[model samples]
Target chain A: MARASVTRLTGRPLLSRRQDGLALRRAMPDRLLPALVAAMTFLAALALAGAVGASLLAQRWNNGAAAIMTIQVPDADAPAATGAGKRGDAVLAVLSHDPAFAAAIPVDRARLAALLAPWLGGAGGSGTGAPALSLPGVIQARLRPGVDPPADLAARLESAAPGTLAERNQPWTARLVALTRSLQACAALALLVVTGVAVAVVAAATRAGLAARRHSIEIVHGLGAGDGYIAGRFARRTTVLALSGGIIGTILSVPLLLLLCRLGAPFASGAALPPTLPDGDLAAYLSDALARVPLPLWIALPLLPPVSASIGWLTAQFTVRAWLRRLP
Target chain B: MIRLDEIALRYPGRDPNRGAVLQRISADIPSGGFRWVLGASGAGKSSLLRLLSLSLKPTSGQLEVLGVSVNRARRAALARLRRRTGTVFQDLRLLGELSVFDNVALRLRLDGLPEDRIELEVTEMLRFVGLGRKLDVRPHSLSGGEQQRVAVARAVVHRPPLLLADEPTGALDEKQAIRLISLFEELNQMGSTVLVATHNEALVRRFGHPALVLERGRLVSHG
Candidate 1:
């Protein structure tokens, strides 16, 4: 009869060495505080890195292409008799002839007035006073995604239209680019630091665990349990603690990120909320929903806990084994 | 049965300043018999018990247990033989984290006894040691006398043919000491060979077992 089946039939499975080990573990004192501390420290580091990294990745990939530049050219200088209509025709002709200029959409007068309403103030209704003319003859150029305007593209445009100055509006793009890069670098450094700290903490904890269990290890040797059995127990305990700590740490850190996004909104411009980037959208919308979602906790949080816990458990096992060799 | 013919055990000098704990010594323990080893501290009485327990090997000489020459024994075979002989350590080798029941069950567990059999044997041993009520309690919670009983229970629970105790009753009061002795006597009556190493001359004198007396690492008398 099969051993397991026989046991099930008899209602008492024969005791195996494996069952004895489990029973022994059940009888042993569980050092919860040390185990929990080791776990929490390990977990917190991972959660910190995970949350920041997820946000950075989302921002980099999703909202990455948001800031765009548009240039406007009113119809080419019209005849002095009907300057407005003729200038518009000339501008359209110049845009059609230029190779650097890909797609130029002329904005009508009403739309231009609406676009300038925020800066110029007062809703543009029939009764509203005529707004001060700001650059009457301008051509609007929309650059392709990721395509940097050639240095001479601006110069050529100015040359095409006398008394017109070509501006790239480079300040906002430069600032956004700098902000994204800075966040990425900061996230990377934070993760590295967390990993280093977890390793050190686990190593110290392993050493302490070995010291406390020295007598038990010797007892194990005396009982004829070899290095493998002894090591297995320590490894099991450490690994469980690390995984638990990781879960708790992840739970704690994600909400902080959501709060930070909320605090930062007033300072950030509407342009910062770019539609072309999904990450930007996530940062904007998911920050609130995921503020409690804890997605990054699940993703980036296991980095150091397993490594640290494994190292700690292994160190304790090998050290005790080496000590046992000197006992007899 | 254990035979150490012309066995010479030594602790190698770590430096010129340090000396060997045991010099070469020869002895034999007959099968299914009881032997008591006597010596003062530093006389290597514990060392001899360690050798017999197979916890230590002779620096030189032939060592055999159960007719198998241990010098020629493979590590796996050595472990197997060691598991068959239970030792009661002088320091009382009880895992403090484990309950008294589990500690006693360890020997049977090592021998791969069935769980039901292990429980039955552990219960019987605890009853014999007067720790039946303390089965679920840990060693640290027990008094020294009670702890020594737990250790004795652990050693004899598996019914190893050879049982070696090093100062098994050192911490017990006179009454408890007598009880511990009677426990060993009961094991000896059950066909298990017993060797006890102790400096307690009064107990040995009263018990009247054949003695192996060691003086300065040498076997000075056998009676």
Candidate 2:
């Protein structure tokens, strides 16, 4: 009879028959493989999320750093003819004329005092009822893109307002950028290591599976099944296991990633809270920290499952083929 | 059809002085020919079948099956050649987890036959072997005789041109053995070249087929 006739006669699809005929996998149960894969995928997703979050945070820091320029007007203590405030006004006026400066605003004495309030003992004045400390007049400037010849601008500003110092914010910005880059590199390296571990875990599991099913494999081989056929079975099985595990791991990691961001939120947004607290209250400390990451970083989290599934599939295929070659 | 010339098979790590399993062995099996291979225990009958099945390569010498040189053929070609030959192992080798029908249908499936055709042929073959009612039963659930029949049905279900049975009747009673041998005879009558290896010399004599006898892994007589 023609092969198609059997399907028609049985009223079953070819795929069902093919699956039913695969007695080897049924003969061997894989209880640990899926769990291992899931755990690996979970760790991998977390690492990937960390890398993406670092990248977004770094970009934000770079943008903020690039636009800022600070000018310090040292207090003269005389408070009379051409004081620090006049010098600050002169610097702002000079910056306003240059196309390179987007905006130049003076920092008021009150705002400066508030910034130094903690160090100066209190918000109103010194704690011992002494007069409030005199602070320098500062100018905050925003520079336009591609107009960052800070040295020339600083020299011009210094000449325009004597006793004033023009400081380009680029040096500190460069250092912060370098630090973020290093963090990103570390996250990426962690992700690579996790992926390698995942592959190794899957490979080891596949080898164990092969050893367990050696008898059935020999029967199939003796029955004329090719190595490709055997390897394809293993690949499909491992891929399914890995895909399920990856989905589970990815799902489980979302809340963890969110909690991480929340914990870091206080630092990222520069929100103020008490620096000193009762020791050993970890939960309370974490509760005070909250952070929000960009939506794109969260969106990238879903791709981990498929990537992990593909890795599992390829690892199984390579393992099976290599193992079979060792046999007669 | 099968051909062997000066084929020698030795297990790896064995003493060299012990000699090969089948040293300088040579034989020819013609198309549609039925032959019985007689030998004592450890006479290398299974090893000879392994060579014919393309599961093992001769250490040195020439072998061919279905007109393809085993040593010279590519791996894919050898697989194709194997597909054209059916073997009933001494151990039966029935997958314990699969149903009897699935065990028989595996051969046809490996040939890429459609589901409907596999079901039809497997059912018909099972019925022919008196196993029509045990289609969904696993091999381990069946009696030893029933499992042997399942193995036989599996081997011949694909209608291969050559069929090899290694001690297929070892687990059968006198009546069951006779029935199984008749099944082999019926298949041979249908133009399949059949080879049966057995220790039952009386049955061999009564069936009156051409016989090849082996002693200590050497072909002693062939007629």
**TM per candidate:** 0.63, 0.86
Q: lDDT tens string, model 2, B1-223? A: 6888888899878888988888778899898889999888988898888888877888888998889998898766777877788899989988876788888888888899866767788888998888988887889989988998899898989878889999888888888788888888888898888899999877797788997787777888877
Task: List the global CA lDDT of all models.
Answer: 0.65, 0.77
- Summed backbone clashes in each candidate are 22, 11
Tens digits of per-residue lDDT for model 1, B1-223: 6787777776665453545566656677777888899888888889988888877888888888877798997655767777778899988888766678788877777776776666667777798778878877878988998998988888888777889999998888888888888878888898888999987788988899898888887888876
Interface RMSD of each: 5.1, 3.3
Off by over 4 Å in 2: A1-31, A75-85, A122-132, A265-291, B72-74, B173-182, B185-191, B206-209, B221-223
Give the candidate number with the greatest lDDT.
Answer: 2
lDDT of 1: 0.65
> For model 2, what is the error of residue B113's alpha carbon versus the real structure, in angstroms, after optimal superposition?
2.0
The candidate that wins on TM-score is 2
TM-score of 1: 0.63
Q: Give the per-residue Cα lDDT of candidate 2 at B75.
A: 63
